[model samples]
Each structure stands twice: as structure tokens, then as C-alpha cells.
Target: MRYALYFSPAETNPLTKAATQWLGRDAFTGETFPTPEADGLARDTIHELTADPRRYGFHATLKAPFELHPDQTEAQLVAAVERFAADTPAFDIPNVIVGQLGRFFALVPDTVYPDLQHFAARVVEEFESFRAPLSDADIARRKPETMSATHRANLDRWGYPYVMDEFRFHMTLTGQVPSEYAPAMREELDRRFSEFANAPLTIDGLALFIETERGAPFTVHRWLPLAPVSENRKIAS
Candidate 1:
């Protein structure tokens, strides 16, 4: 199995509910929702566009997926996640909006925030001990030749091309959307996620997601809030 660290709101968060409906899957429950109603868009097309993110579920990746190192154990990783969540305080991204990343649609910060950057970088650095080296197939799958020099270096050292300076925080909503469909998708996503558009998004928790095997859907293994346990909302593990 592979594991990923992500930033996901509590299961009850409005953003989580809306995104779950749009993607048609809840990472927390292993449940599938009906494809959200999108006027003028075919349900089949909506399904096709959202297929990728649905499999992964709703999350803003903090640390990309990795297998445990030979020297590490799942128990150790869980402990580390809990400690980190307890010690690190919660923060917010000033404003977020529906934006396109290359050909895909996602919720992205209006501007790069320093605190978010530092927090994401730390997650990468802190978990270095738990990440096994990338296998040849994994490396090839990242398409290093198409990446920038900096990205290639990061892939070589960190096992993920997007980390530290290369990270662009986004919660992916759909896969590659043809240029012709961009305008409609943007409008539809804006309607679906309007409450969060140009609004602050709290960085409240660190979620550990588990992928049972290659190509399997990921599910929430744990949701640990950044606040101390006694003060935070009751959340499931």
C-alpha cells in the first residue's frame, strides 16, 4: 500500500460536502455520490472530466504518495503525523478561487502565501525518512524529460517533482479539459464552489490517506486537526 499526506477539512465541512458531490466520491467514507447537476453539460462528460480526482478524492496534497522506507513502520508514520499535527498550529490561505491549472480545473489560492509554502515544505522535509526511493517505473511515470531542470532535481532527490519551490497548491477538480470546454467548466465550477471563491480557507488538519494498491481509490486513514485534541471538533480517526 502507498500513503499520502493531504490537507482535508473535517468530513462535515461544507467544502468537503460540495467537493464530494462534484467528484462523486467521499474519501472519508468510501462512498460514491451522484454526479452533480451541471446545466448544459452531459452527465457522461462530467463523469469523464472528473474521473481522475474522484479516484483520489477531495484533497489538497501536502505530501505526494510514497511507500514506507525499509527502515520505517506504519505505526511510526502515524505517530509522526499526530505529533506534527499537535505541534504545528493552524493557519489560513487568504483567498481562494476556482482556477485552471494547465488543462485541469481546481481550487487554487489567489496568491502564493508564505506560510502555506513553509508548511508544505516542512511536511516534505519532515517525512523524508519515511519515503522509500522511487522505483524506475515510478520515475519514468513522472516524465522527467518533459519537466524543468529544477523539477527533475526535485524528482531525483525528493521522489516528487512538485515540492518546495515547485509546489503550486491546488485541490484538483477535474482532469485534462480540452480547451473548448474550459469556459463552461470554469463557469460550472464557480457555481458549484462559489462560497469558497475569494474566501479564506483554513488549514485546519493533516489527513493521512491510504491507497490499498496501485490504481485503487484512496480512503481517509486518519484526520488529525492542528489544534490540541481537547479544543478541536470531534473527528474520526
Candidate 2:
């Protein structure tokens, strides 16, 4: 089975709920939102511009989508993920606020924390062997023109472009907005998130989402809290 590790905003967070409604269709259910008519309209507008139905919805990818090695057992993968979480202590995410990443909107950190950056980097580096190499066709579809030299190199090497320095954690709210609609989208997102923006959000938990194939929305399989590692425990690969 293929899996992607992502950082998702807590469902209980009001801002997240608001944004979730605005997205209209839950990528998870593929069902359209019934209430909040304005939210549906905004979502439709954003989705039209993006024109990529498959990329919609929320969640921030820490490790890009990858298929696990067929030979590896699920038990082995779960054990590895648990080991990584245990060794890494949970750290606070400071200044989490809604912001635009190009045309799409997301909740991003105010400043890059060394611990989080290092942790993400380690995930990319250590679990890389589990990933199938990106095919030339997939690379071509990525379009080098849309990315920087560094990002292109990352894609070629890591099978994902947004890792290491290019990484910015974001829970995607929309696909991409047209220039004409950018102002309106930004306004709506800011207004929707304003209530929660005043305070800090702590990220103390790690979750595992399992998916079987392409075009599937992963369900949360495990939510593990990051705890202090014992000095005597040696982490095995």
C-alpha cells in the first residue's frame, strides 16, 4: 500500500472547521457541503481555477506521497513510525496562522522551528528507502518550469520536491485561485480564521494515515503522542 505522512489541523479547531466547510467537498468523503452557501460558492470558484479535481482539500504533507516497498510488511512500517515518534519529543508550533502559499491558502508557522524542520528532514531522509522512485512521466507532469532548481533537484533525488529547505508545512484549504479571485479568497480565509489567530496552537501528537492506492483519501489509523525517549533505548532502523 502507498502512504503519505501529513500534518493536519485538529478537527476541533473552529478555524479549521470553517475552512473545511469553505472547501465544499471533503476530499475524504468526496461529498459536497450542504450548509453555508457562501462557503460552497467560494470553494467552487477556487476549484474552477485549479482545474485539478484530485488535489483539493486539507492536510499538510510532511512526507510526500510514496508507495511502500512491496517486500516490507505493514507491521515493520508501523513499528518504524512508532520508533521515530518515541525518539522525538513533541514541540510547540508557534504562531500558527492562515496564510497564502501562492494561490492556495494554508495554516503555516510564523517562524521555522529548528526541531520541526530537523524532524521533517529526518523523515524524508530515513524513510526514503520505502519510497518507489518517481517515474519520468510523473516528473514530466510536475513541470520543472513551475519549480526552482533546488526543488527540481529535490524531486529527482527524494521523489518529492517539497523537502528540506523547500518544505513549508501547510494544511491546504483550496486548490489554487485565479488572480481575480485571490483578494476575495484571502479576505474570506482571514475573516474565517481571525478568531483563532490570536492564540498559539500546540502540536503534541503524531498521526498515521493509511491509504491503499492513488485517488484514495487516507483515514487516520493511529494517533501517537510524542514522548521523551529513554537514554538506554537505542533506535533501530
Candidate 3:
């Protein structure tokens, strides 16, 4: 199984409910939801547009998926995640908006947030030990020849090309959309996620997601809140 480190809101968070509904699958619950209706898009088209993100569920990739290192065990990785979460303090993004990345759509921060970048980098660095070296197939799949020198270097060193300076935090919402359908898709996504548009998104926790096999949907193995016991109690109180 491949494991990924992702940023997802607490299960009770309103954004979690909204995002799961929008994506049509809840990673935490292993439950499927009906896709929201859109005026111009057929239900099948909607499903097709969402197929990729739905499989991954609703979350931002902090550390991309990788198999465990030969020296490591799953239990050790879980313990590390718990320790990391306990020590890390929570923060928030100033604002998030629906934006298109190439042909895909995602929730992206309106402004660059240094704290967010730092947090993601930290996760990648801290978890490097748990990641196995990329196989020949994995390297070929990334197309290192087409990538810039720095990205190729990153891929060799980190096992994933998008890390450190290359990372852009985005919670994907849909797969590649045809140019003809782009405008309408954006409008519908804006409507469906209107309540969260331009809203501050708290970075309160990270989740562990497991893919049972290649091309399988990931499921949430655990949700680790990034707050101390006392602070969490204070917030609850």
C-alpha cells in the first residue's frame, strides 16, 4: 500500500462536510455522496470531471504518496504522524478561492502564504525517512526529461518533483475539463462552494491516507489534530 500525508479539516468542520459533498466521497467515512447538480453539465459529465479528485478525496497533498522504506513499518509511520501533529501548532490561510490549474479546478489560496509553504516543506522533510526510493516506472511516469533541471533534481532527492519551492497548495476539485466547458464548470463550482469562497481556511490538522493498491481510491487512516491537549480543550470550552 502507498501512504500519503494530506491536509484535511477536522471531521466536524463545515468545510469538510462541504468538500466531501462536492467531491462525492468522504475519505474519512468511506462513504459516497451524490454530486451536486449543475445547470450546463450533465450528471455523467460531472462525475467524469470529478473522477480523479474523487478517488483521492478532498485534501491538499503535503507529502505525495510513496511506499514505506524497507527499514520502516506502518506502526512507526503512524507514531511519527501522531507526534508531528501533537508538536505542530495550528494556523489558517487568509483566503481560498476556486481557481483553475491548467484544465483542472481546485481551491487555491488567494495570496501566497509563507506559513503554508513552510508547513508543507516541513512535512516532506520530516517524513523523508518513511518514503522509499522511486522505482524506474515511477521515474519514467514523472517524465524527468521534460522537467526542468531543478525539478528533476527534486524528483531524484525527494522521490516527488513538487516539493519545497515547487509546491503550490491546492485542494483539487475536478479532473481536466475541456476548454469549451471550462467557463460553465467554473461557474457551477463557484456556486457549489460559494459558502467557502474567499473564506479563511484553518490548517488545524493533517490526515494519513492509504491507497490499498495502484489506481485505488484512498481512505483516511487517521486524522491528527495539530494542537496540544490544553489548547484543544481551551478551544472546545
Q: Rank by TM-score, descending? A: 1, 3, 2
For each candidate, how many residue pairs have backbone atoms clashing (under 3 Å)? 0, 0, 0
What TM-scores do the predictions have?
A: 0.95, 0.79, 0.94
* Model 2: how far residue 95 lies from native, Å: 0.4
Question: What is the Cα-based lDDT of residue 164 in candidate 2?
Answer: 97
lDDT of 1 by residue, 103-206 (tens): 99999999899989999999999999999999999999998899999999999989998999989899999999988778888889989899988899999899
lDDT for 174 (candidate 3)? 91
- Residues 1-237, candidate 2, lDDT per residue (tens digit)? 567666554455565466556655444444566434344345445546433323434566778777777677667777877887777765566677877778776677877877678878887887777777777787898997798899989999998888999888776665677677777767776777787564576555555666666666565555556774455542530
Native-to-model Cα distance after best TM-score fit, residue 133 in candidate 1, in Å: 0.5
